[model samples]
Target: MDVQAVLKLADELVFAKTGKHLEYLEEAILRGTIQGQKYSQIAEDFHLSEGHIRDVACELWKILSDVLEENVSKANVRYILERAKFYNFSTIGNDNLTINNVNICPQTPQSPQVTQQPQETSTQPHIDLGDAPEIFRFYDRTSQLTTLENWIICDRTRLIALLGISGIGKTTLSLRLIEQIKTHFDYIIYRSLRFSPTLNATLTNLLQIFPQQADIPQNIETQISQLLNYLRQYRCLIIIDDVQMLFCSGQLAGQYKTGYEDYQLFFKLIAEVNHNSCLFINSWEKPREIAKLEVNNNYVRTLVLGSLGLAAKEILKDRKLSDEEAWETLIDTYQGNPLWLELTASTIQDLFGGSVSDFLQCDAPILDESLQAQLDQQFQRLTQQELAVMIQLAKESEPVALPDILKILQLSVSNLVNAIRSLVIRLLVEVKEEGKTTFFSLNTVMKEYVKNRYMR
Candidate 1:
């Protein structure tokens, strides 16, 4: 039962009880709920207050409850509706007809056409956005979306790696992309490897989405082969998120965990094999296979998501921040990262009454506990050398060149180069090129975090 079918039944039930159709807000709430979006997201999307949305949803549930003869809520509306649909068909007649175990009663000549079961057939793409985050408000990613759409629809890129720092909106951008171009593909499946599922388990989960899964192959090789065949047969757009979980935390970027090595092979085949499908992975660190694959195949691509730039002012605007001129300074301080700016905005709201300049007047950047905790997770994943480089950069007020870092850290040229390269890939260090000299630095927020947490 998809969202549209559920909505149709809901409208029918609502009209029968109230003699009127579902209102715009009520319909928006229902659609959002059915799609696993939160009430806050629904409110933001519809330009309504959260309290108003919640009140509307409460009234909706009460109305649905009265008609269904049971309690209905956001949590169980889908289940209750499905049960009601089944019950409605089963009680239609004394001599009931069953189709595929679902009772379909024979309609009399006088019965209305609405008594017939709705056909589920459609040309709409099969989209399974499993646990994808609801985008409350999409800041401008016009260029990014255009590039990704061109790659998938025009270039037919087989595999893409969406890389960015933590909370830089990689997942959000991908979800937005799916919304924009979902109709172009036959299948759209999103799965997260956040818990680090094994290759076999991941394959099984993905394969289950397709039909004829009554007897899945027991061998890993056969499972992979079957999935490849399906990918070739249909234009599937699969998004595997939280791919950084597949790598070892203590090692350098792109090094897989010991037992998860076979993922390397799986990804390689996806890039090399002939298929009319696109499989994109989201991660903080690029996979080891991507660099090599991009060189060998034009279809393999990588997009490193950067700061939101001027578009990020929308976030501050929603936060109701003051001192428009200071907004740019604040954004630059936080490097225009949506989540970072959001957290800092709350701090300003609480302590300075939404004055961005007041927050900036403090001796140092505010690294609230929540922001610190998030940065801690990213720092914890760095190697010792990377940590050393981060500490050195934190000590500098301005961007520093390579020779200065070498002089301060007393490290080998190759070691410094490797550490800086890894840090860049990790998106922790900021790089700037002036003339022929390259300089590196950390954003104000990160520099304060490193100083307070490590340089003490």
Candidate 2:
């Protein structure tokens, strides 16, 4: 086939299998291969990286192999082109066998006398990682982006705390924000405490990211002082993801025992002084002293991200459902979590025969015990009546106002309001204001689990 026709067919085939289009570089490589250009020549001509060109060519071969039902190689590029010509694809090559008039036969035919072969089925889809992009995908939290941006840019707010439940995209959002604002600072460092690296190891990693000619300091105190001086000398943004793993409780912020005392001191220094702008993304609440310092002192700000929004729902729309309502129901049931949405979307095509509403409304729910444990830890001190009010709101469809909650739970308004305020203080339920009225929503994933399990 002509290069244009082959490119067009490849585009259609790629979109048919994967719900995304071939990137521009992929198209250029395909056209170059059809023209019999050497990879080296193509790389130099386009001013492209040689490795990048080869990667694209490899992906193109995989796509063509799947579409043509045969192995495609650099030596057989011409053969593939002839096959395309036989399939009535337009071509400029001389080996065309009546390109426009050629009749391509089907791979299999239906006949009474013919024996048919059984089709094999597999549970997993074939994914070519070579074709995947290098960038990580962020799922949700537009409001969180704005909050982080404002804190970083505004002089009044320096240290920002990103608080959320586990697996709620805290790390992902922080990484994305850093990627966006990386150019604003001379140095940007992302350190994860998920593995609970020791103070020495953590400082070593930080040094590796931005090397200094001076020898490493011997002790944690001197090391931290030198690091702080380095950061203060240059505009830097440091992010500490999974910061909760470093601390045991909120009270003793800087009181780590034995081996971890250095880390505690590091945190204490960061909290006490304002040398560099730092962002801490964690699941648990900060230590009371740290939080108090942030609130009373104007330099630090706290931003808690909840869940995905309507825009995040659009990511699943290409999954091929029967209608928009089914899609909406699925998004609601999964709370627009990217991983959950992707997992559920893959199986949804088969579930079309089942009732979408019934599927969403089912009583069986996946117990996210970690989230439950966190909430329990936060609410263990509350009284039974207060817990009851929280449970009612957690299971409610609409945001239950104080009066409605009191009526449903058969409790006094004063008592119900107190419970609601307690929940809000603990960041269990978010109170949203709309003019004179206020509404509440449980933490995103919490709402999904509660509605699916308790309210049915």
| Whole-model lDDT per candidate | 0.82, 0.57
**Alpha-carbon deviation at 71 in model 1, angstroms:** 54
Q: Which candidate is the best by lDDT?
A: 1
Candidate 1 structure quality by residue, lDDT tens digits, 243-347: 999988877888999989989999999998877789999999989889888997977999999889989999999999999999998888888889999998999
The per-prediction tally of clashing pairs is 0, 2
Candidate 2 lDDT over residue span 34-58, tens digit each: 7888778789989987766875676
- Where model 1 places Cα greater than 4 Å from the true spot, the runs are 1-122
Q: Give the C-alpha lDDT of model 1.
A: 0.82
Residue 324 in model 1: shift from native, Å? Answer: 2.3
Check candidate 1 and list the clashing pairs: none
